[model samples]
Target chain A: MAADKVDPIHQFHITKILPINVGHYDVSFTNSSLFMAMTVIAATAFLILATSGRSMVPNRWQLVAEMSYSFVANTLRDAAGKAGMKFFPMVFSLFMFVLVANLLGMIPYFFTITSHIIVTFCLAMLVISTVVIYGIWKHGFHFFGLFVPSGVPAALVPLVTMIEVISFLSRPISLSVRLFANMLAGHITLKVFAGFVVTLSAAGVAGMAGAVLPLAMAVALTALEFLVAFLQAYVFTVLTCMYLNDAIHPGH
Target chain B: MASNVNTTAEVHHGGAEHGGAFPPFDSSTFASQILWLAITFGLFYVLMSKVVLPRIGGILEARHDKIAKDLEEANRLKADSEAAGAAYEKSLAEARKKAQAIASETRSVLNAALDAKRHEAESSLSTKIAAAETAIAGIKAKALAEVDGIAIETAETLVSTLAGESVGRDEVAAAVAAVTAK
Candidate 1:
């Protein structure tokens, strides 16, 4: 381990597992894909099997499943109202996927799926696209009213609407960037701190004592990272709900 | 640390340089990542909406309804027990009243019988007292009449023997009557 620098960025690197060339596009099954698959299976299995008992009095696993269910349900209801519940599956899927992936990434050496901007972009796009499609479909041309807020002065209408449009367009970018950045920064910081401990402790007795600081920081950061993991998921879901709200009642 | 990171990045990238695109921002991996995300997230969505979510919702709803039903049943039972308790109290009160009535009736009946017996005994005692008084009166009158007669006979006999002459019967009678009267 001497002179070997801990590469914080290495963990996020996507390596081809089973390469699949799809007509000049390399959509190879990578470690990222494996983890996604794992996330899907894990989330599905846990949610399904835990509630298999369907007991009137829920056990621990069932209780967690129910709590998460109601948590998302409440979030969706609060943000978008009952009409937004039609997109519950999509919102819930993204939340579970992000949450599970983030937690899985907490394991040492695990590739974080959410750390990638493209993945979060796709999820953000999914939410935005749903808002667009459903908004247009449900309310027709009236959905465009979302950009025009009520009670604005007639002179500022154009300016306010343009700002609204730009803001609306930036939703996907910000949504993706926020989650990606949080996870990316957290994981990298943890790795760098851990690397410091390793590099320092190998130096000397004094270096080992100095390593304790980073070590403690690493432990504290790990706890914070876990919180960030759940928080990001919640934020993502909440934002998704809010975006879906635009679709349900665009005038508001 | 900087040299080491650069050195490894160089070696790892086949000398693709130190400032090459970070893996997260890498465009080459986007296609693969997007494809897989769609596949996995789509699968998860389908599984949740189709199977898992509804199942969990059903469980929660069932538990909710079951709890409500149990509560309602408990309330009903409570009311039922209260009704039975009220009925018990009512009967207890009725029985107490009936028992008091029966006791009073029995006491009154016994009292009537005792009064009748007392009255019969008093009347019989009064008749016996009257008979004793009448017998005493008869004795007393006979004694009194004998005393008067004895006094008159003795007086007449004294007068006759002293005067050496027998007294007339009518005069003796008249003399006895006057002495008795006085």
Candidate 2:
């Protein structure tokens, strides 16, 4: 290995393309920020194009937009009922952003913001805080009683409350880590197998034969990763709805 | 699962602990993360509220219209079937009445034929009885005439034998006449 060889993770880092200092923190725009902006622009353009020429019977593009809307609408309705209508905009937007970002990252050399724990954690925190604050606002001080199981014996109320509170706090941790770990591990494994293919191809005929297996595996993993990316986004959005449901109806 | 995740996390932290061997978890990424969240959030909000929701509302309204149209068509078909069924029943009733009228007409004709036949038979029987009575009266008259002739001849024969002489028929007859008169 060369002394100056860069680590793969460092390649993923978002150092400012045009360095700028803001107070003590380095808040200059980076490659990750650029892609995030691009994702927003692309989503806006796609939705506008899809729905601009709305037809009574719907064309192909219109059908796609309608399906995407109804898909999220129905998911929220099923998970949280009529109470979820207020949260529809938030949930639908989250799904589109995550879905678009994950898909865009598949393009070679594009940064995947969702693959970073800090990014995933911030989103998770937003969702968790929304549910907690909304639940309190909607239910007032009585929302604290959500931690206590109604049918339990009085003797065990304290223990059950503690367990419930701990579980409640674990929500953001689990939600954030689930997305982050899947993206990080999948990308790293893909890189490793790609490294294997390169290393073997240089070592003559015998090495080429060995390269065939890892190359096949790499191809398979890439397709699987793409599916995982979409699935993880769906899981994150759906779990957010479930949490929102508890917030709306705290007695349950 | 928890243990496995902890071990992975331990490895990640362990790599950093052993003298900057690996990159430490960067705190600087926080700003970028927040920026990305905000941008994505705004993008999604505008797109959904303006473009997505309205399209969905249109589809729902269209589906509702289609369902209502189908129900109207079904209701019309049902009414038509019921009307057709009623018409068939009326025709069936009319046919049954016509059949009963034809049967009654045939019955009346049969009754008239039977009455006429009965009258002719009674007349023939009465005529035959009258002819038989006339024949019986003629037979009695003939028998009475034969009996008168036979009584006169027998009286004459008897008188002639008893007297041992040829007594004239007129004398015998006269004696018989006198005795009959006394």
The C-alpha stretches of model 1 lying farther than 4 A from their native spots are A1-5, B1-6, B14-19, B131-135, B146-182
Best by TM-score: 1
TM-score of 2: 0.70
Find the 10 residues in a row with the least total lDDT in model 2 chain B: B16-25
- lDDT string for model 1 (B36-143, tens) is 999989888999899998898899888889999999999999999999999999999999999999999999999999999999999999999999899889989999
- Which tens-of-lDDT digit does each residue in A43-121 have in candidate 1? 9999988998888888999999999999999999999888888888888888898999999999987889999999999
Q: What tens digits encode model 2's per-residue C-alpha lDDT throughout A1-252?
A: 210111245435554665556677666677777777887888777877877776666788777777777888888899999988899888888887888888887665677778777777878888889999999999987788889888899999999999999999999989989988888777777777776886677679999999999999989999998998889889989999999998898873
Instruction: Give residue A191's lDDT in candidate 2 (0 to 100).
Output: 71
List the pairs of residues colliding in candidate 2: none
What value of lDDT does candidate 1 attain over all alpha carbons? 0.89
Pairs in steric clash, model 1: none
Cα error, residue B108 of model 2, in Å, equals: 5.6
Q: Which portions of model 2 show Cα errors greater than 4 Å?
A: A1-11, A18-21, A52-61, A150-160, B1-24, B75-79, B82-86, B89-182
Return the TM-score for each candidate structure: 0.88, 0.70
